[model samples]
Target: MLEEELVELRFRLGDGSDMGPIRYSSALTIAMLKERIVSEWPKDTKITPKGSTDLKLISSGKILENSQTIAQCRTPFSDLPGGLGSGGAGGGVITMHVVVQPSLTKTKTEKKVDDMPKKVTVCSCTIS
Candidate 1:
């Protein structure tokens, strides 16, 4: 039997930051990859992904399907996510863009703010 091939992939954030050239089996599904990304996201960042559902991965200008594998989503002779280097097939790395959807709570907060009165002041008066 042939050895299982391992591929490296990087997740690029909307802020232009790179997550990793994390290794995975060529057969790994997109859904599993997303889970890995969520777990690996930097805690230092202000934006935290609530879950995998709020994240989307894009490659070659296309959104990757959850059912697809690492091999299915990569391009040939591509460089690693953080300018690490370039390679082909087994050692090559694929870069995928991470898009974070806005939190639903933020929209609700905005609406509440909009509905509130714009101005409020207490007045002091003396009658003589």
Candidate 2:
């Protein structure tokens, strides 16, 4: 396939740093893109995603669904959100923002009832 036919993509972190000008087929799914992002994630970043489930990809103010294709998520250059532009030499690169979502397991810890101290109240009855 010709280079122009492929979609050029870049990933931007919450810190405003960018990842790549990697070329991909428009047919690629958002889930697949997340996998790529996880693999190419920078080691120096303070926040890291443990898996695709921990990452959220946003483009043009829309959070891309896992089932959505690259083509579906792309927007016209003029309509690009967040001041993003068509970058790269060819000028069609789409910059997607990557957000690391805290996992439910990490954010919500279950406490065992047995671990808590029981409170006991003594009832006193007085009869005249």
Candidate 3:
């Protein structure tokens, strides 16, 4: 397998940020890409995904598998935008949509109650 066949990939996050125009070999796996995304994720984001399991990479309306390669995911030049490395050799940037689905450790009710102040007040009244 020739590693020279490089393809640029861009990951679009939920925050409307493009994570990469990073070059990857056609042989790179989707699982590997997820790992890269997790590592490159912005620290400033409030909600962080626990691991690669929390991520989903979609291309051409299809959710990519861990075993799948960049070559399998490559898109045609006409479909890519200029910023996604549409100029050079191999097919244009294989833009992938990233969906972060972090597992919820607590329920909605738990979150709501946790935010409430735990204070008690007593009122005494005299009636005639």
lDDT of 2 by residue, 27-119 (tens): 789999899999999999899998999999988788899999886776455465543334334546677899999667755553445566789
lDDT tens digits, residue span 5-78, model 1: 67777878988889887778778888998898889899888788888877888987898889988777764334
- Displacement of residue 89 (Cα, Å) in model 3 is 2.9
lDDT of 3 by residue, 74-120 (tens): 64344556633343564555678999986464445668899999998
Q: Would you list the clashing residue pairs of candidate 2?
A: none
Score candidate 2 by TM-score against the native. Answer: 0.69
If ranked by lDDT, best first, what sequence of candidates would result?
2, 1, 3
TM-score comparison, 2 vs 3, better candidate = 2
Candidate 1 vs candidate 3, lDDT winner: 1
Candidate 1, superposed: residue stretches over 4 Å from native: 75-91, 102-128
**Which of the two, 1 or 2, has more lDDT?**
2
**Which regions in candidate 2 have their CA more than 4 angstroms from the true location?**
1-4, 75-91, 109-128
Worst 10 residues of 2 by lDDT: 82-91
